[model samples]
Target: MNNTYLTTEELAGRIKYDARTIRQCLKDSVLLEGKHYIRPFGGRKILYIWEIIEEDMLSSAQSNLTIPMANGAVWHG
Candidate 1:
C-alpha cells in the first residue's frame, strides 16, 4: 500500500514526539533518510513515510522489555 508522505511536524504529531527528536534520533539510526524520510526535491521541506516510521516504532517497542503489572515490584526481562 502506498502511504502519503507527511511533514516533520505532521509526523511528530502522529508519533507524539518532538520534530527535533525525530530528526536527531530516528532519522538516521532507525528511520533512514531517503528510504523512510527525505527532503522534498529542491525544497527545504522534509517528508516522512507514515507506514515506515510507524512500523519501525512498533518493531522497536516489541524489542524493548517493559515491565507489566506493577505492584511495588520490578520484573527484569
Candidate 2:
C-alpha cells in the first residue's frame, strides 16, 4: 500500500493544524476513518495515513471548488 502512517500530532505538524482541532473538529467531518485513518486491531489508537491525506489535500487545493451556501446566499467565484 505504501502508506505513511502518522500520529495525530505528526499529522497536525505536517498539515500545520492544531492537534486538538484535528481530533475535535476535523476527524470525522473532514478526515474520514478507514480512508484517512485506521484503528489497528479495532483498538483505541488511531493512525493517520499520510499519503492519502497529502494526496487529497493537494488534489482538493488544485480544484477550485466551494462550499454551497444556504439561506439564499450565493458564491461569486
Best by lDDT: 2
Model 2, 1-77: lDDT tens digits are 68889999999999999999999999999999989999999999999999999989988876755567887775544
Candidate lDDT (C-alpha), each = 0.82, 0.92
lDDT per residue (tens digit) for residues 1-77 in model 1: 88889988898899899999988887778788878987878587778888887787788777786676658775555
Q: Clashing residue pairs in candidate 1, if any?
A: none
- The residue ranges of model 2 lying beyond 4 angstroms of the native Cα positions read 65-77
Candidate 1 wrong stretches, greater than 4 Å: 66-77
Per-candidate RMSD vs. true structure?
A: 3.9, 5.1
What is residue 49's positional error in candidate 2, in angstroms? 0.2
Each model's backbone clash number:
0, 0
